[model samples]
Structure formats: C-alpha cells, structure tokens
Target: MDTNHNKSEKSFKIPGDWKEQSKQLKEKFSTLTDHDLKFEAGKEKEMLERIGNRLRKNREEVLNIIKEINLS
Candidate 1:
C-alpha cells in the first residue's frame, strides 16, 4: 500500500457552498488573508497549498478546518 495514496485519499474538494465556508474560515482564522483563500474550480490543491502555507497547516488540516465549517 502506498502511504502517498492514503494522503491523497484524505484530501478533499471545496464544497459547492465554498463562498460561505470561505467567509466562516476567514472569520475563524483571522490570519488568513484573501490571497491565502483564493480558490478556483479544479485547482483546489493549489488553493489548499496557499492556505496551508499561510496558516502553518498541512493539506489535511486545512481540509479539516473547511469540514468544520462546511455546514450550509
């Protein structure tokens, strides 16, 4: 089994309600700037990388943060 596969399996796409989720995330993590949260459809990995670098988090952690505020 490839551990890399496990990492990819844990990755997630931004939800359809991402605008709302983005608002919540900004409110929750004040350090996150607009640039850090910039997202484009089919480019979630890059967006997550930006967010992770700014927030000092890994991809999975960023996904978890989004999940926590994903309710719409």
Candidate 2:
C-alpha cells in the first residue's frame, strides 16, 4: 500500500526545540529560510522533503543530516 512513501511521510519527529535545530541547519546550509524549517504539526515530512529538494539530496541523506543535528 505504498508503505515506503507513507513511511517517508510519517518519518522524522521534529524536535520540540526546533529553533536551535533550525539555527544549526542554517549555519550548515545558509540557503534555508525559516519557512523551510518551520515545524508544523503533522508536517515534519513535508519539511524534510522540501529540505532535501532544496539541498539536492535524497530524503535519506537529508534525514541523516537532520538526525545528526541533535548529536551536536
């Protein structure tokens, strides 16, 4: 039932403290605007997809970068 797309749509739990995370992302990639990183309820995947497209990266790579943001 298109589980992969569904999965990608549901993946990535946006951080509660997203501003700091967004800041980190901006530092790493200056092209991202607040609108790109804006975390809306149930729209985490949309944001990720937009980021991946903007960065010319795949969702998995974008996901990895997002995951790494919290590590530092």
lDDT of 1 at 8: 44
Candidate 1 residue runs with Cα over 4 Å from true position: 1-11
Alpha carbon deviation, residue 15, candidate 1 (Å): 1.6
Model 2: weakest 10-residue lDDT segment is 2-11
lDDT of 2 at 28: 99
lDDT at 68 for candidate 1? 79
What is each predicted model's overall lDDT from 0 to 1? 0.80, 0.82
Using TM-score as the measure, the top candidate is 2
Q: What is the C-alpha lDDT profile of model 1 across 1-72, one tens digit per residue? A: 556764645446777677777888899999988888887777778888899998999878988788778753
Each candidate structure's count of clashing pairs: 0, 0
Clashes by residue pair, model 2: none
Error of 1 at 25 (Å): 0.5
Q: Supply the TM-score for candidate 1.
A: 0.77
**Candidate 2 local lDDT, 1-72, one digit each (tens):** 555656534457875478898899999999988888888888777888888888889888988897899888
